[model samples]
Target: MRRARTSFGALGAVTSVGVLIALIAACGDDRGGFIKNDRAFETQSEGGAPDAETCLLQCSLDGRSIIDSCTGGVVETCADDLACGAAKCQEPCAAAEADRSSNGCDFYFTQPLSAYPFASCFATFVVNASNKPATVSLELGGEELDVSGALFRAVPNSTDLELLEGPIPPGESAILFVADWDPTIPRSLGERLYHTSCPTAAKPAIQADGYFRSGIGDAFRLKSNVPIGLTWMYPYGGAGTHFPTATLVLPVSAWAKEHVVVNGWEANVGEPVTQIFAAEDDTEITIFGSKDVTNGVGFAGATAGMPAKIMLSKGQFVQIAQSQELTGSLVFSNKPTATVGGSECANLPSKAAACDTLAQQIPAFEQWGSEYVGIGYRPRTANTEEIVWYRMVGGRDGTELEYDPVKPAGAPTTLSAGELVLFRARSNDAFVVRARDAEHPFYLGMHMSGADGEESDSPSHGGMGDPEFVNVVPSGQYMSSYSFYADSSFSEHSLVIVRKKTHGAFKDVWLECAGNLPDWKPIDSAGQYEYRRVDLSRNFGPGDSFGEKRCTTGLQRMRSEGAFSATLWGWGKYASYAYPGGTAFRKLVEIPLSPVN
Candidate 1:
């Protein structure tokens, strides 16, 4: 059901392309549907003189110069296979890389900077592996900030707010802030888009948490002088109507242009917020929607509807703001791109519980797996325990779908390609959601109860735990080790949950936060795999950064046998969030099952 992919005409008319996708466009007002992007050609240099043998330079189908044949500069990370050649060599990560735990990495693994779907409030921390001090810079909320004299110790309280307040140190460790920190304001961190709650280098160090608005859908970039490990959180503190606190450990350089579907939060009231980032300049993204449920060009594996087809360019982003329940929309891009989805705040069954914000950057279809263990979360709400719901999207009509431990009667057993379905489980129920045979590979996600909804008619998010979301980790993407931050805010802070992706049990499991994991009690029901919540908050204090742990929350590290899926959960006060656990696993490219010919 994939469309013609891209109009990928040659360069400009002065350029050479097959179809006429305006190499020069005006704000996507042209007929070709290419979003006008001032940054589109950033990665390509001007052409050099052509040799007699051949031009040696050719424009990519997407209308980009493959190798500045004119300048003698080849696109950065082309592979020996020639696959990573011209068309996809839009990123520079191929040239610079840092040490990694896993081996399958490629140019797309480690770069000096990393990109993630943006959120205004996140409890973030970092680790410096450089021997000399490192300076971390941030681009957020419409400002540029830098941190200085950063030192790292294998201990806690390594960072002091006073130290971060300025004449910053070099090569040392400290927590950075770029917020409107006005202690006088009650809705500072949670409600307002003030504190990224993230540890940034420094942007006018001590500022008060400002207005309630935030740059929620903006693309955020973190640049560092040295190879460093960074992690951020949509901590458990809920604001006004923002619900479902979540956490994600991004592989700074691990970005892909192709993503399948990232599900939304709650049901009726939950509007989907989609954020897409172009890794390379002048990149083109043609989004497809299964939710449209149509059959046409660009309608290949989709069914969702939208405004005239949308397009994107380098460094630019597109946000759906708040759209209809598009939890099942599909985005198809010609270049490597990154995506995240959820809601600014949402509730289930419209009248159920309170609201919470949701967000997660998901892997593309090529990276998706067929098996999953469904272990839901228990927020403070609900009478008994918690429930887990699965949003499954198929690629073919009548695709066979099933579950383990049994699903409710009349539950869905089939899916049409591009069809999206949200299936709810009984209270506190846990089960395995898989295809009858594995022919129909689909995507799945989980949700948590936003509020206790006990006796109060009030919407959930108030002092009740807000809704929580985390995509069901596919075993195929599982890694043996990961580097991340563990929130040290003891009260209601961040926790790590680990389980097998399928029937296989994993061994050699280890969690290192500050020190090695002292506890990992087995939890319940994730079907056949390991289930445990590891808490590292006990090892950190206010503004504390364990230098030994690279100044990150607890610098939690994990290693296990067999393929396992792990996720980090944020739960504190009335807010909470969740996201899949991942390593900086590198790859040559993140494309589709079928090449974009």
Candidate 2:
């Protein structure tokens, strides 16, 4: 999805009210202006200036400006071919091609699907509120779904979805896949999708890994003119008729460089894996405690100390594998990088043949907060208790620990660099972890047991009882309001966890549940914020499509008093998964307790 700086909000809307803004693309309108398509829509930022944000400068062919893009900015009349953009001028493309210096309509870029984790994969989309054709990435490899395929809302939910190229839309939803590798288009982006963590002037290009790779798993670079939510899944390994494994891939704008990865696989007693993809090149990365740091105690995949230093070219990546629990392993980079970590296949201590998979793109260190209030994950089977674990990263020598609804934590007076303290809890345990001081700002994550009790026959086939990872983020980084995507078009099934930023931060936690997710309850309230749990089912999922409904499987907003964060959960066939529903804008700090905006 192409999200431009417009009136639209950061995340897509909870309600589908029309938000249209006809902005032209950079091309010939001959009036010396840009000629854009109807697909353009603008969004309004919540705390931004009353006016919509200005557009980035695109040059004019004749070195002229039909209109200035922003107030007081340069009129930019350069014929520089190196100029990445141009105005959507009044002239037509056919006529503009005559000018050698013009960079016409180059904004129309396509994303190609290359290799994949499964022979066949399915993609479900949540289109931008913009009612344009951008319901999904227009290109899948070289093949494009019929533009009309986006109209899933008008189509009855009773229709067999597998037969359709995509769900119908007015910015509703859609599905796509590459049955084989042949649909490859002109490589929209090179080997990697996003740029490396380094800048061009600083080092070489570092490309990212494939969107859907086998052991490496799936990921997406959500760089779009129109905003949309995407969750792709593997057809096998799941229990029900639907695909088993699925996760929401955060947009590139949400990616970060440093991550305190928790190896959920360790809890399953299985080997753990973590993958780092460069957002920039010559990206010098240091992997602490992976193989390099802990002798053989770390990952088997590490190359350098192999834990201490990892040098990745633009878009390059390395998957760190470790047989032991990566107790407090840390990954740091000279610059920003994108990291994904989890177990390839892990079974909770049960030893079930059904070792389901787990993974999440870890957010950058900036998203880490000094405080965290955690709610336990539901156990996979009734009578079977869910084992929950918490890992605290980035605490210091003087770092103190505080807890509520308390349990036994050996509060240590000090913690060394790259050292993390781990805590384990049973199902439904409500607890809080806050560094006594901000100087020890840290992060928290949770791991739930595999689906041992989740299904009856699930273990006989592909996988069973796999542990899953969930990110409990810093409320300070949460969205004041945001929406989530449905896990499946079939049986309704969804749950979301939300917590307001500060005490009495908002009058109410939910604006509305969109009717589908009709149940909610206050879980924990003693901490700085209260957490409300919400649920939605197939009746509330993508069925009988009027389009996305309330509780689009998420919490929409908190009264403006403050911000809130969310994590969404969904299950299919036999597997379970969850992802942070909000975006992150982390600010790297050189010092602990540094003032963060």
Candidate 3:
């Protein structure tokens, strides 16, 4: 089996279409029709036994004894003067020459060949003449590299598979064993084997250990093209069946499947084509179908107790026929609502109206894609009347606790403070968020200190006091935005967290006046005082040092209008960031949030 890209959309109960470019192999032009003769059985003598003289064939030109047969006590041999198999054996022959086909075709084998060295290389293949139904057994060793599926492409010119099955009349069935031992080589890529006895003319099936490696167990390796996200690992694990034109799954449960229409196109069952785009709470993926798909097909697989299997870690293996040409669409089962400002935040003026909360309506299958990271809007402070966008710079968990709250080396700064900066990065977690166009503005907010718990320090922020009014309270939830960026020097980085209000133990407070962001409407500008309870248990921080420490900002304004609308950016706990400049990026903060929500 081959490893492929992971899929994020509703893989089960879904039929995704794929397209592939054609591959051609070299041959003289005679693409078909080769025949086999009776010479294959000419060696047998009368009474179905070889005569003594007939059994003792000639040897090679050098006169060396060629092995004929080894009976109970006799070691029969051939003369060395004969050509081994390659030519008529008039005399004894030396070792047999490598096997070759009638049309000057040489035998070859294909299998993986390295130990995960991380490159594209060829696996070793060997050719031999063995006409038997072969059974291959694979065992895992050395770090256990994953295999997708194994297949054999038939040689273009040869008699029907019956020849490989030993003439197919009683004395038939000779199987050959081919071995592939490299971890870095790709076997099923583009090679074909020559055999006349292939059980059926159809393609062979591929198998993977996606579900139940042994008996029922719950451990599974994370699979995805996105940097960070986790799929539930039911004991059954993940798996998908293949079809000539599409990889379709009809979810057994009706609730998991969703239907929608976009741009006037409706999704109908069993259509030759279909397209779906990703939604905010769902992973950012597009699904296309080559044939009309229905829940009935997918439901059968799911009801059979199959794990919610999708494609592999990558979606490349899910091939679709090119003729179908599907246009897919994506819609959230639950839509996300944006929140605008009011008295909910202490730093804002009592009458200011510019904060927006872009909250998601968590769906049954909770998933989020962050096209941009650390993105959000916040006020200057509780005492000021202006709104600005504060972003996350460089941060770290240090795998321990430390104290200090200064800017880290290469940390980014706003060219103009309070000037809405459109920063981008993975969320504290690493979901992917995107914009329809670069010009469209995003929504924003900030955090502020509250009355009772506004004067203590936590270890997450370099042991320095947490952002004035925006301390991390044990049980409060805050909505924010994020952006990730790398500079030309390859040494600078940033992670910014902006919130509307803060209410836990912290060090200071600010008074900021605010207005709505420049070009967006609010879902509830008047009732903006709603409170949501949250537990950020997995986040890293309490340190105050900006360098090597988590960076944060409290409310910069109560309601300052801007040109962008607010949106939510979330990344699960384990996400990796890849800086554009070829430098490796790792998560410095966990965002301290619980998954219970």
Maximum-lDDT candidate = 1
Give lDDT tens digits, candidate 2, residues 1-597: 211111110011001100100001111111122223110111111111122433544333222343343342455433322221224332323222222111122111111111122222223334332223342333211223343332232133332343334433423443333111112323344412311111111111111122221121112222233334444343311234221344444444444555665554553434565666554546677665523332221113343233566555443344545565554556677776765556656665446545655555555555555655577644434465455556555534466565655653443334554466656676566665555443455657765545443344222322332455666765434433344444433233434455443222332444344432223344334424455454444433542222364334321222222345556555543456565554334342335322112
Deviation of model 2 at 95, angstroms: 33
lDDT tens per residue, model 3, 1-597? 333222211111011111110000100000011012111111121112222222333222111232322221222333333323322333211122111111111111111101111111111111111112222221211012232232222222221222232121110111111111123334443221200111233221111111100011111111111011001100010011000000001001101222211110111111112222111222222222213222221111121112222222112221111122122212222222110011101111111221111100111111111112222212112232222122221111111111112222222332211122222221121111222221121212222211112222201111111111111101011111111111111111122222221111111111111112222221122211112111111123121232342222211111111001112111111111111100001111123211111
Judging by TM-score, tell me the better candidate of 1 and 3.
1
lDDT for 377 in candidate 2 is 42
Task: Sort every candidate by lDDT, greatest first.
Answer: 1, 2, 3
lDDT of 2: 0.39
lDDT of each: 0.40, 0.39, 0.17
Worst 10 residues of 1 by lDDT: 21-30
Which candidate achieves the best TM-score against the true structure? 1
What would the C-alpha RMSD of candidate 1 be, to one decimal place? 15.1
